[model samples]
Target: MLKHALLSLLLLITIHTSNAATPKGPLEILRHSLVQEVFAFGIRPQDTNWFDIEVSTNLTDWSRLATALSTNATAFFVDDSATNAPTRFYRLRIPGTTVAQQQAIWTELRRRTYTIQVERISSSGKYLSADVTVTSGAKHISNVKDPLTGEAVADFDPADFPSIEEIFTKLEAAAQTGIYDLRVWYDPKHGYPTRMIQREISGMNSNVTELRFNLVER
Candidate 1:
């Protein structure tokens, strides 16, 4: 009987040792801070799993922020949208979750007030561009110029210039139609499109538009 008991105890110890060696999921936060109104945080994650990052202002309604793959090393993250919020909270959700719709980035941008310079190039080879400033109540556009001439547009119609909102609308439509060759790049911090190119390949409309945006002031 004593020999049998010793064998059973050895088997249990072996199982526990094996289980402890395995890495676990759900990343752990190491440190976090708000610098220059941006949320900067560090996390230690298991190499075996991916994590969904979520953030909130009230801590009750969480919004999916981003997804990250763990490398078993310390990782750093930033919340550029934090600049507009007075209070912010964040967490690392469980593995296997997916990123939410693309609209999240636009939502982040709505909270900010900034000035951006836009450069436009179109199929007609003529484009009116300007530096645009947006605030709480009104939009201020200045330095309106014709890129084709590299001169100030003496008689510029604001309606002829596409705003950021309009660019996004065009992108969304292109995405849904599945007919245009579209390539877009976004600002890492603000999540707004920094560059976009759309070429209509269907031969129905051979319009190609290229837009480049640069943040001038926050």
Candidate 2:
């Protein structure tokens, strides 16, 4: 009987030691500061396990940003449409896991995810300020420019050319009306454009010329 008890205690100690080595989930922020939108990417469970992405302004009263099952890589976006507050915090909650597993999950998540925040804009609207809040990331920003004039092109109208330059026109119009295009990019590195936000605006003026994007750092 004493031999059996010693074996059980040894097994318990082994299990505890193993549990202490697990990893946690990572917190990646796509947008932070001077911007209203945000994105978080992390490894979530597949189906059997469950996780919750929580956001808080005060870090006390937490709100659910998203909920998922298992630790599969996933991305989620949130807009401060309801409340325009500064400094938002986010965290992940994983149930039915050892602490070591949580740490490993977090490390992998950080490796794959990066957090960035838009800082400020340049005077001439040629360049913008980007501040890296975290580590392990890369960022680039470019725009459509007149080949001959070397100036940022801001002539195309969304209403006039809805087919060829539909996205650009819509965004330009939005910027003209005091609504900012927080996610429109023409990256020279990638040789393509991508839209991060899609919304309509009214009462735009035609004299609006330059558009600027401030990329946040990770």
lDDT of 2 at 9: 20
Off by over 4 Å in 1: 1-103, 109-112, 147-149, 157-160, 201-205
TM-scores vs. true structure, each candidate: 0.46, 0.26
Cα lDDT over the full model 1: 0.58
Candidate 2 residue runs with Cα over 4 Å from true position? 1-21, 25-48, 70-72, 79-82, 96-218
lDDT of 1 by residue, 104-215 (tens): 6655656457777888788987687898877773677889998777899768666545556666666556444443244455655666677665656444657777678887
Clash counts for the predictions, in order: 0, 24
lDDT, candidate 2, residue 193?
26
Best prediction by TM-score: 1
Specify the poorest-scoring 10-residue window by lDDT in model 2.
9-18
Q: Poorest 10 consecutive residues of model 1 by lDDT?
A: 9-18
Q: What is the lDDT of residue 106 in candidate 2?
A: 37
